[model samples]
Target: MTNAEPPAPRTVVPIEPSLLIAEAFNQAQVTALRHSVTSCSHAAGLTGQRLDDFVLAVNELITNAVRHGGGQGRLRLWRRPGELICEVADHGQGISVRRLSERARPAPDTAGGWGLWLARELSDTMAVETGEAGTIVRITAALAAQPVTRPADS
Candidate 1:
């Protein structure tokens, strides 16, 4: 057989959403998050309303991983269906759904649990999958095809 190489499994394509590549460190994670959003916006041709949704979701997911996903992780985002899907994978011990639900409840007069809370609010669907590889928290936010209009016209 010839020595031709096979296609790469994890190919980074032009995503309408952002993808972050960084260590498990907090500072790096933060910078990666911001860059991911900008990249996504630019790649997806996002503007105005789309930008708002993407920025909000990106911040929430990145913040959550930094605080709860054990320290370091990798983030990947893409346009799936009509929604933006983000996957934040970390090499932490992993978290239970029950624990996540409890922690997601923000305390009164405090901003601490707000990341998870905001993630849940902005995302149409959220789920956690843990294994020997690590834990990957997936978050998805729906995107409107066109700018939503207020009522008034018949």
Candidate 2:
């Protein structure tokens, strides 16, 4: 048999969900964007503390994009069954490995470095994809509280 070339590596792309809001933003638009996200998230069934936490998490992502990811970015918001999702993408240098790996609370004395950490803490789940070209952060919050299940004592 003739020598065969190795197969190309597969790239896994997440399927696009139906979008509720999609917009481009810059420093001047941060406030308006946050308001829009808040409205959309509320309409998607999040309420009270969950709504507030989700809005705060999204704000952090947007602010980070402005401050660290080149002053402008794109945002997308959507819903999937029981969860609401928001994604922010910016074209700037990628995040360092050290920053990505550190998930602890920042020291109270620290002046900055709270955005990503706060986003992670506030959302039900958070994911980031970054490289020299840009960075994308996606955060999800549940629309309703999930029940906690306990195992039977044997």
Candidate 3:
């Protein structure tokens, strides 16, 4: 047998907006999730601006799931170490980003292409996993006691 490395320890974090249920596609569910995240972050000492960023990224991911993932999905939000993480899962057709982008890149006239792109850009880290069970898009943003600063500040 060959030598194998042990798995790294998982990061433990506070779970606030845990396992949100989206029974049907609607504007209210999206709004509720956004508010829930921002409120949780703010209560945990995360500032308004930083909360806004988290909300934006989370909304984009969630919206994409509801709109593209057959009009329904599930979401989970938690704080991991120094970051806030949001995971949205859908039980519909999975996305193939490679083929979709290569076939016809969403242009200015496109409707929903910008959501995922914006989510990835706003969050510190973004990843997507799709399988027969569902598609889950994970987004993370660094939280700070104060508002986030631009890199140019240094």
Candidate 4:
């Protein structure tokens, strides 16, 4: 007999199918996923400066998923009332939260190290879920209330 505890239950977030984009991204499929994410974002009514910001932030995360996240992952996008949500998940070793924020900004000459930081800065809110099995980053950008325009009267 030996002292041992039961394994903990997993905490992977379930993707909402109603608004899901790409279910998985591989080395050859990243471009398609990017297009899907942007198209969904556009259809969700993201536009102008806010639209560009959201795309940039999400692109960084996708790049990280390809370069660092075992060269494959998943991407999803959806609309939530006043916000647009994007989620990227990878089946690779996780990075600690502390390490994720080590630098405020990378040096100009530095080859890289700015993906996660930029995501947090650009998105309205971001959450990170990581473990030995995988990592998922969910980011939200508040949708600017579209201006109501009325027809001009003679």
Candidate 5:
């Protein structure tokens, strides 16, 4: 068999930087919303494990918005260059500072508090904005694998 060099990575150019999916969802719509996010994210060039991870992260955010926020929330998904971004917002009283500051994984016996942790762990980056009016959680995952650099030997 002849040896072949790997093909160079290609950059993805989004057709429209506008939102791919924007919807208001409640508990009943969570499953459907997840499917839509999967389709849009795959179309935006995220695939395989990366795509799965991003979808899961989005699901967690949505669930949290429903369960803790105010029983309803809004979701926005889009892409920017090499990354896919998703934001979930809810109109509840807002998350407390103590809850927002805890980054440690929950204990095995814990009954709740896994959503935000999972979202943060699965995405490339995550941010939260909260106040008396509402809370918004934004997360992003790279659409392409970043190249790993190695130091030259002395």
Candidate 6:
């Protein structure tokens, strides 16, 4: 008998509009956008620290889009079995996503340059698409069951 490896999953495939939460936002509407993302994430079955990481990643992406993506952009969030997925897109001049991925690390104390880095760190898988048209960043993180909380000694 011959053994063969299964085909790899397509990480950059198009996301259907009805698959999950989808919204558009601009610089003026980030606060409300964050809330909506959190709600969608919760509904998609993420909790505990994994949920927190996903939330932070989306916040960074959306904030980056607002500040840099021509002052507006769109966000999409979805799920696939054990994974939670999110995508942030912007219609700006775009960037060298390759360079962004190669960066060693930005200073923690700096106020800027943390968006791409943070998203990569927080998610299990990250993909980037950029061009003269716009840029779309997709990230995926695995969902974990709730951890047991223990009482500390008083």
Using lDDT as the measure, which candidate wins?
2
TM-score of each: 0.62, 0.83, 0.68, 0.79, 0.82, 0.77
lDDT of 6 by residue, 1-154 (tens): 7788888987786645435777889977888888887887888777778778888998999998988888999888877767888899999888775656565678778888888888898888889898888889999988766567999989
Better of 5 and 6 by TM-score: 5
Which runs of model 2 end up more than 4 angstroms from their true locations?
1-16, 145-154
| True-structure RMSD for candidate 5 | 11.4
Query: Where does candidate 6 have its weakest 10-residue lDDT segment?
Result: 13-22
lDDT of 4 by residue, 42-62 (tens): 888888878888888888888
What's the lDDT of the predicted structure labeled candidate 2?
0.94
Clashes of 5: 0
lDDT per residue (tens digit) for residues 1-154 in model 5: 8789889899997666858998999999999999999999999888999899999999999999999889999999987878999999999899889988999999989999999999999999999999999999999988775577999899
Best by TM-score: 2
Error of 5 at 41 (Å): 0.7
Q: How much lDDT does candidate 3 score?
A: 0.71
Clashes of 6: 0
Candidate 3 differs from the real structure by a C-alpha RMSD in angstroms, to one decimal, of 9.9
RMSD of 6: 9.7
For each candidate, what is the lDDT? 0.66, 0.94, 0.71, 0.83, 0.93, 0.83
> What is the overall TM-score of model 5 with all chains considered together?
0.82
Between the candidate structures 3 and 4, which one is better when assessed by TM-score? 4
Task: Please give, for residues 17-134, the per-residue lDDT of candidate 3 as tens digits.
Answer: 4433333434458887778767776765567666677678878877888777867777776765567777788886787767335434359877657777777777888888886666
Cα RMSD for predicted model 2: 10.1
TM-score of 2: 0.83
Q: Order of candidates by TM-score, top first?
A: 2, 5, 4, 6, 3, 1
Q: For candidate 6, give the lDDT of residue 94.
A: 88
Ranking 2 against 6 by TM-score, winner = 2
